[model samples]
Target: MTTLLGCDFSSAPSRRKAIVHAVGHVDRGRVVLQRQDRFESLDDWAAWLADDAHLPWVGGFDLPFGLPRELVEHLGWPTSWVDCIRHYASLSRQDIRDAFAAFCHQRPIGGKFAHRATDGPAGSSPSMKWVNPPVAFMLHAGVPRLLGAGAEFPGLATGDPRRIALEAYPGLLARSVLGATSYKSDEVRRQTADRLIARRTLIHALENGDPPLMRDAGLRLRLTHSQRDALADDASGDSLDAVLCLIQAAWAWQLHERGDEHWGLPAFDPLEGWILGA
Candidate 1:
């Protein structure tokens, strides 16, 4: 059995809002939710990834693994994904914000942010956007740590073959089931009854493999009653998002078992990595 992980990442994590990891493995066609781990700091998360005891695991992380090719070219940065990530790592958050802001300033309204090709299929926020979702900062903070841990990103970069990392977006799964219904919120006030209901509905669909995407992948989520309640009761949705990512990781592993070298990801620009399901 292949160990699997699904991570809900934060560029700047603290005890109040830590990075959440859902750890499990695929059994039969079920993606079982074994446990959840939290990291209050990037250092802690990176250390966890580097730990040999955690070796031979494939993980789906909810962060952009690379920047938009257009943004990289516009900044005259190195076209190589590794070199560009190294360059990105050297800049502080303020530096990144300023640079991305300048890039947006040069473009016209409605086209302010450059996006990766996966953004269209994944329905993700632009990787270069420094605000709102702040995925640019996510890419800034995440890619370097993955590199430092020597995690292998299929078709993008080579590292520890035992530690495979793939880009994942939980929204791709959630939106497929719930459409535009908002299922969770970080703010207490925004955690409405309807959102809670939506979460339950989404979870049901996942467990039963009701969605075409889930059925096609031949994967369903398996959670204990306590686990089910916990995932639904968390108003923040971080735990649930991590589970969604875990499911994606399981789908990738299924493909690998069938000998898909790219782990089901299509041919994509190495400088702008593709999301696992997208």
Candidate 2:
């Protein structure tokens, strides 16, 4: 079986805000959690992924794999995935900020951000946004490693076939389970009882395969009592998000096994890649 992984990334990871990865697979209609690992630095995570033993794995990573096509076109960057990413990698953080700032400045106040086509369905922040979530920096920090690792991104780069990466948004999965209820907060003061309850509800939904996405595929999550508690108690939701991505990765891998073209993705713009389960 292909090793399945889900990654919750941090653009500027540190000991306090590490990247979380869930590693395991789906077996007998159940998504099993073998382990969850933490990496305080992207370099360390990259090195871990580069190990030969880690090949033949497919991962759903919570990071933007493509920029907004509108922004790329306005900047006159290459429209091809590899070329566009190469060009984006060459830019400094300050350079990216200036360019994105200029783009926002030219737009109307309420429409300051340029969004990718997938943003609507995925309900993700604009990939060009430089602050708050800082996903722009995530692409800057994460995509290069994926490229260098030769991970194949469907509809993007067909790199090392054994190592596949799909752009994923955990919010999409969580929202399906909890609707608009918020289940995570970085601020300790904001990690209220309501959020904790919501996390438990979300976990219950996953275990039952209540969502149509899971129900249709006959998939239910299997977690130990301790593992479930750990995911629910993580106020930042990084651990839960990693598991969500892992489920998404498993769905895509299942589709691939069934010989589905594009690995279950809809008709997508190659320059603006689609999220795996969106």
Candidate 3:
């Protein structure tokens, strides 16, 4: 049995909004939810990721693993993914914002941000966007830690064989079930009855493998009553997102078991990583 991880990441984590990780393992066709871990600091999270005890695990992390190739090339940054990420990790957040702002300033309206090829299929925010989701900062903060942990990112970088990291987007999975219906919000004012209902609907779909993607992969979520309640009760959706990622990791692991290297990913640009299911 292989350990599996699903991570809902935050670039800047505080006690109020920390990184959430869903830890589990696949049993038969069921992805069992063992427990959830929260890290209020990046250092704690990084240390946990690097821990050798978690070896031989595959993780689905909700963060962009690479920048848009166009963005990298336009900035005259190193074209190699690993080197480019290293260069990116060295910069302060202010430097990243200024550079990206300048890049957007020269572009026309409705095309302010450069995107990766996976963006269309994955429905993810631009990795360079510093506001709203601030995924750009996510890439800035998250990737370096993964690299430091020596995690292997298929196609992009090679590192520890036992620890495999795949770029995952839970929104891609969630949107399939909800179809633009809002399910979660951080603000207490925004967390309503409808959103709670949506979360329940989503959980039901996962348990039944209702989505075509999940059904096709023969994956179902197995949660105890307490676990189910915990996932649904968290209005922030961080825990649910992590479980979604865990499912993605399980899907990828299934493919790997069947011996398709690159773990179900297509021939995507090495400079810009691909989402697992997308």
Candidate 4:
């Protein structure tokens, strides 16, 4: 019995905008969300993840695990994943922005960002982007903590083998559930009826195992009415995103249970790690 988690992360977490974590498990072909909680600080969450009590778990975290290999090579950074992350950690946000901006400036207009192979299928933001979503800051803030926590990343590295971590994107799963349907917003007024409907539809799809990955595995999500409403009504969508990642974690666990090697991850670059389910 392995504990599974999905995390909707914020690079800069606070009481106003906390990180949401969905804790759950797969039981008798159902993915159950045991609870959802918020962490107001990354420090607290990192400590919790590093604790011995949290072992024997797999977590799908909504943050990029690696940057584009092209970007790393172009910047003359170390090619080794660990070393590359170390170099990335050493640089300030401004430094990163300038570097990435320089890279983009040298490239053609249609392709301003250097991308990882998984980006094509995952539709994830470029890990180097320092603004908008500021995922670059996420990589800087999150990956180091993951390394310090010593969690294992399948096909990437082995750390606390009982505690596994994988990169995940809720948008990937959400898009599969509801193509081009808007389901969330941070603005109060933008939390409209249509987005709520989209959330309900997405939740139903998960319950019915509508995604090919869920359907193929004969797994469906189980949630109470209140839980569904909470997921739908949260305009920030952090809670719902966390649950989506939880489902992804369950899928990975299923693959592991069935003795599939690499835990369903494709052969990947050692530096530019692959996203789970990408």
Q: Which of the numbered candidates is closest to the native, going by highest lDDT?
A: 3
> What shift in Å separates residue 197 of candidate 1 from its native position after superposition?
0.3
Tens-place lDDT per residue, model 4, 104-191, is: 9999998999899999999888998888889989999898888888888777677887889999999999999788888998889998
Summarize candidate 1's per-residue lDDT along 33-134 as a digit string, tens digits.
Answer: 999999999999999999999879999999998888998999999999999999999989999889889999999999999989999999999888888888
The reply for model 3, stretches above 4 Å from the true place, is none
Against the correct fold, how does model 4 do in TM-score? Answer: 0.97
Clashes of each: 0, 0, 0, 0
User: All models: lDDT?
Assistant: 0.92, 0.92, 0.94, 0.90
lDDT of 3 by residue, 1-278 (tens): 57899999999999999999999988888989999999999999999989988778899999999999999999999999999999999999999999999999999999999999999998889989999989999999999999999999999999998989999999999998999999999999999999999999999999999877789989999999999998899998999999999999999999899898979899999999999899
Error of 1 at 262 (Å): 0.8
- lDDT, candidate 3, residue 196? 93
Candidate 4 C-alpha error for residue 159, in Å: 0.8
Q: Which pairs of residues collide in model 3?
A: none
Off by over 4 Å in 2: none
Q: Give candidate 2's TM-score.
A: 0.98
Pairs that clash in candidate 1: none
**lDDT of each residue in 1-278, candidate 2, tens digit only:** 78999999998889989999999998988999999999999899898778879779999999999998999999999999999999999999999999999989999989999999999988999999899989999999999998988889998889888999998889999998888999999999999999999999999999999977788888899999999999999998999999999999888888888898687799889998999778
Question: What residue pairs clash in candidate 4, if any at all?
Answer: none
For residue 215, model 1's alpha carbon misses the true position, in angstroms, by 0.5
Off by over 4 Å in 4: none
